[model samples]
Target: MGMGVMRIPRSAFIWISLFFITLILANYGKLVADAISMNWLVKYPKVWVFPLKDYVSLAMQWLVEDATFGLFTFTEATRGLSWVIEQPYNFVRALLSEGFERGLGKSAVQVLPPLSWLTVLSAVIALGHYAKDWTLAAIVGACFGYLAIFGQWDSAMITLASVVIAVPIGVGGGLLFGILAYRHHWFGRLLKPALDLMQTIPIFAYLVPILFMFGFGPVSALVATVIYAMPPMVRITTMALQSVDPEITDFGLICGCTQSQMTWRILIPSALGSLMVGVNQVIMLSLNMVIIASMIGAGGLGFDVLASLRRLDIGGGFEAGIAIVIMAIAIDRLSQAFAERSTSYVHPKIRNRIYHRHPRSMIVLTVLIFSMVVGFFIPMYQHYPESHTITTGAFWDDSIKYLNINYFDQFEAVKIFFLKSFMLPTKRFFIGIPWPWMTCLLVFIGWTFGGWKLALMNGLMTLFIVTNGMWAKAMITVYLCGVSVVIASVIGIPLGILAAVNKRAGKIIGAVIDTLQTLPSFVYLIPVVMLFRIGDFTAMIAIVLYALAPAVRYAAHGIRSVSSELIEAGIVSGCTPTQILTQIRLPLALPNILLGINQTIMLALSMLVITALVGTRDLGQEVYIALTRADTGHGIIAGLSIAFIAIIADRVISASAKNARIRYGLETTHGH
Candidate 1:
């Protein structure tokens, strides 16, 4: 009996202890409460709060002041760096917008000598054809044509300029760091957590420090976008390098290849598929940050969208949103095609074709030559005429007005029902939890998953939240994310299952998922506000729309990833489809689904600040307020709180997924 007792698994022991603790707390609640109320345990002093925000703000101020007034000359250095960065942006903007300026000062000659509209159109078509196929060419051409017709050429070009600068920097930096991390164990360990923090923190949080360091302008926006987009690139690169075949490495060693030679020729070439995927991710993230980047004076279509949102001009917002969507889709498709092509096996004969041999160079040369000739002849060809630009803003505005007039009562009822029956109650429950109890509960969960280390970490995080006096706001943010995730899961899982089980359904659903994932998250807020009105309900709706794609995607991926042999075994056993799904597929897929949930949660947290624009009393609102008020300390603290929450969720969920994999023998159990 003693031997058996000692042999109990740690998880079992932890659960049993939790049961007893719950019983004790239930039966003698006041006693436990009183014990926890001890000053050392519950009353965390203000002095205990790490004034990270204040410290960061002070450092930034010192840097700026010292650079300006002291001998350090940091400001001069930054300005010089800024000038270098601005050159690309200015050249691109000038090429796309002002064309060529020929005159000096007041008598300077200016000419709208940009590429002809037709020349630009033909260039996209040619590039798309080179990248993918004729379908892609048509799509790319149509998208550019839409921008021209809509008078969005200027803003779109500005965004493209920033992307052109940021993506390469992000991709290159990510690859460099990823290689470093993969090569050195200690560096990998240090880098992992930093990547996690970077990935989780709100976009606005990134802007605060960037604004301080770089000051406000396109350069700061570019820097922030690069930072935001780089983590995934780094993560993917590291994973690709690490996952390179061991046999290949051994073969390289046997062939007397140097480390550098083997890495460059073998590992990197083999990891092209993953590297390209990383590139795709970087492109998507760069585009996603365009709007957020506008917060610090990175003007473009994002600024237009923000202005429209502020003025409550649904039509204008919709137009700009459409432009953004088109841009996103064009970029996403082109990058995806490139990623796909990187891994594709091409015949040497076909590869030698003139177009295929020098696709990009040829396309650029052709466009430039054609544009110079045509632009010199036709003014409209050089610059799209404003008088001819399309305006659908009035149509959207009228439509929204009509809906508001006709459906105000119906919309109000729906809002009231959701708020009263779900949102408010959920909000209250999270906010009403006693801080000490909540902290203890989190600790218990952490202990169950990862022993004392995680428990202590979780406890410290909770303490940080409580002591910072943002418990209520934090809880509200949690509630919003929680509810959004729950609803997303409920809808997404079923849809994912349906798609996984049917080929036709999979194609259609996959397209929808792509659209959702690729569309700028901010775009969701417009239509959501139209239907729900602005409040917690609208914010929740917007978050759900924005965050739902991952749940569906992961669920489908997980289900589809289940082994064919497993399904065959069930069929051989005369099991029904339902039995196969429930007993075999779902159990095996749960880990992947959990991964999706983790992603969904992260995305929801990211959307929090954006949702604040629609009015929500959460950490997102706090960050937004800090931005508007220029309170760097408050913004940083609030953003860090959100990051902490995401980290906690990521750690706990990842541990759970690992355990699930181990139980299924998909992973080794040595760690456990």
Candidate 2:
């Protein structure tokens, strides 16, 4: 293909190829030996390796020293500034343990005991009916009833409580940060990288740091969960607030409202709808963190799920997974109902008690609160505030031990066989390709799909990875994620379109997709391993499953959101349903489909770290190893490698989608 005005010379490309070839040959032996070790170095036995190690060590030490210095400064300066006070970190830990014990202990007695599971089911059903209708009520009640009968009520509650605490904290922090970002441009600029890292850094990669700083317990888990969950809120809040109507603010000011009044009464209320979505996200993400946090000693359903997997008890693990899905659905539906509810003022009617009273929703909420309070004061309900209600560490430990003896050997044997026969060969095939040749292939593919700008962007991304000594691992990640994205696109696009074509299917599929998107993918990993066994195939399968949601969701949305007039136009042309869908709907939705594919790729890569649990020598594994060993140098490099890939994909896809949108006149080109 011919180059654009900005293209590099053919000679430059040739020299670049020669340089990469020489670099590869220099590192060829070591690269092939471990395949993964090359990720840390451009070539082996190089003088730079020692310096890199030292640099990483020095950086970690400095971080530790700095943290220690800050802690000491605060403690010495303030009377109440110990780790508990200065850290106040211990406060959350204590609340999770001693606090829960005292409260639950007291409640256990006075709280009317376990009420028949039927009673609980009835209450949920009533709640659903009151909130929406019979259909929603049925779902809510059935999910709760399933949890109770399946013997997961306590674990589910434990998980719920942590989420109850973490969601508010994350939402509050995110809102605060977001408001700060909006009011101060420099602050937003400064926060951009921190937020990017928080959003893009794999969850597992940060667990080690969280464990190091807070130590293993509920508090560390809470902290990590909050950190992971907070970024989206911050980004959303800022975006939502920025999008608020200026005209409404002007009206508020015209009515003699003060700055604060305008902000609170007008800006905040208007932004409330979008802000609620952010809150929903916070809750979903916080719940999802339960399983991963379990890895570091936070117990609840997540720990149970992990425990079941370790024991190779698919039935038990699957049950725990279902409970998570149920909890996610219940919370999601409740939050969404409130978010979508319309608000209107009504004058009191003549003499009806209901007309004179507050809204029925408020009344119902009050009753629930009153019930909990009444339940709280019974002899069984009071707590001394120092006891934690439940512990799962021993349960998990025993389960792990039993599984190790019974199932681990078989797991290992299968893993070895798969790796030797299938996975290793596939991996080697990709690794055998010369770096320069691969670069050309990627650029060519990008150019064919979009244009030269995309090609250039893709080429530069590959160049960065190769130069940073991350080419091999990057390629491995690419290989697996590549297959997954292709599969996910195939499945998600069709499902999305089908759902879009039918109302009932849309609601059901939308709900399922929502549940899958919000529930932690880690919980699904163990079951996947049991069914498929661990290898690139297993990892790819997991990726495809986890990553499919975006494609389906975006495709459904893209089709459904199409202007009715356009569809009518196709109809007016006497186009058949199939012809309209193919020539108009699909073509128009292509941009969104491409965008979905982009997200699928990013999500697949996010799973890279989690898939390490199944044993893959990818960038995620490197990050995990770095975290385990506290190798900051290696960790930073690996983390950046993932970030770079995500950014590259994001840029190219975003550009292509934008191009499509403009070409189709769905949007205008801003600069041009």
Candidate 3:
């Protein structure tokens, strides 16, 4: 076998995969297809297609109107960086919803006034009781007083002034590209496949190259929410500065310090609690890219939940998707209570005699200078009046129009009993298979889970979606993200094994998977399109409630990370507790429930591209019809064929979880 590889015999590719599945169940499915003579092996042949979206729209119209670097012209250096990020996003949306004006329109002259809704609700209940306490300062003071009692306080304060300037420039450009990819090894191997193609593409394929390089408004939605919340804070600051503790870098190099004071005082204060969980995942992915950065203009509360979900107005888009889940649970519990707190430690001369020691920032700078000096003689303390607000958007559109006029045939008989028993027989058996025998059965199951370079990179990225014609909309985006990640891992792995063997059902299934992982996939398509209305069975019940919190937080953290001395050596060898939860905690929680079903199939293919605006043509409705026809080469070839089908289902579920931990020897075939 000269240089042309051979190595076939894995029981002769398991009898050629059981005679190619008994010749596709004897021609019914037709891998050996021939509609007439060979109807292009199950349909892909419109004369071998592949304009590749008019050669990526003439190389993005010559890189946005004839490229250049010297003496400007790449559209005048992106319109001078969209007028330098629209001057601090129009000075934090006019210091939180119109309060400062000068002299131009109506020959302006307000001067300043914005801080009042009782001084930004007493500075968000004194920064939620100085980050953590008084019951998270009374649950972020009743979710910042339900955005000024529901009239969605000026579009939730202009989406909290573009999430306070896109979370400090996405946590200081993810800690300066996580400290230049942890002090450069070829810049952490070219910054990890460009942060895994900026976290597997598709927040509307990052607004068609940020509306062709920041051309749209609100500084192209705050530079696509700071490049989609800076790649998980540069992969959580190069994994919290490469998990610090090497004897605190040899006691700051035996105290001779200075490599910038041992990387800023011994590895960034010993990696400030894992860089505050990457600043709470860049404040919940910049409030989950503010409802797809409000299709690139970005007003706030994701443009009032995309103009109340495009006027179907499910109670004004479920009160702007519950004021973006109460400002993402009060800024994810005040940035996780200011990264697990630390206060009472003063000593340096009583910390320079309590140098204005933030008694909740001196009571939010004395209630924002006594509500801007009583909002210059009370105009309802400077604005909170719209005829004294409070609106349940017509009481959630008259209680979902009286439950679609008395439970429209019991929600159309439970969406026709889960679409004629399981989403139209799993979308007609994945669009009747045969895309050349489902790309040679996923390239012989990625060459039986990882080999021959993942079966030639899974038969060339599943034959580039059948030569880019989009094989039946990428098999209806893999049967609606594999039946919404197998019904959210069968109802989130038994409510995560009853929240890991009951401590009151692990605090009620850990407060219902922490408020369903702080809502956002466009607020699970407004109460399942108001109790199931749209198709593909309301996009598989809003992608199984936005992929049920990573299958109940990776099955209650892989059955509470087993090994309590192997449950006391299986209770002294006479095991019980159902033989210690089915033979040692479900076979050591099957590699963390196969990494929580690979993060519930990458959050059910990123909530199936926002369930293509509640219809289902897939590849997220061709990246939302190439972001309404702007078409950056058909939205980057349908957002890189949904990032090459989430990188070939995350490399065939990480090589089938490393061949099931090397057939349960729990890994070790040679590499150490």
Give TM-scores for every candidate, taking all chains together and pairing residue i with residue i: 0.89, 0.75, 0.34
Find the candidate with the highest lDDT and give its number. 1
Residue 631 shift from truth in candidate 2, angstroms = 3.7
How many clashes does each candidate structure show, in the order listed? 3, 11, 0
What global local distance difference test value does model 2 have?
Answer: 0.72
Model 1 misplaced stretches (Cα beyond 4 Å): 1-51, 67-71, 102-112, 254-256, 344-367
Number of the top-ranking candidate, with TM-score as the measure: 1
For candidate 2, lDDT tens digit of each residue in 494-556? Answer: 999999999898889888787678666876676567655666777876887889899998898
Per-candidate Cα lDDT values, in order, are 0.84, 0.72, 0.80
Instruction: Give lDDT tens digits, candidate 1, residues 148-263.
Output: 99989888888877888899999999999998999998998999889988888787876776776678899999989988999999999999999999999899999999989988
Question: By TM-score, how accurate is candidate 3?
Answer: 0.34
Q: Give the TM-score of candidate 1.
A: 0.89
Distance from true location, Cα of 573 in model 2, Å: 3.3
lDDT of 2 at 487: 75
Candidate 1 vs candidate 3: the lDDT winner is 1
- Considering TM-score, which of the candidate structures 1 and 3 is the better prediction for this target? 1
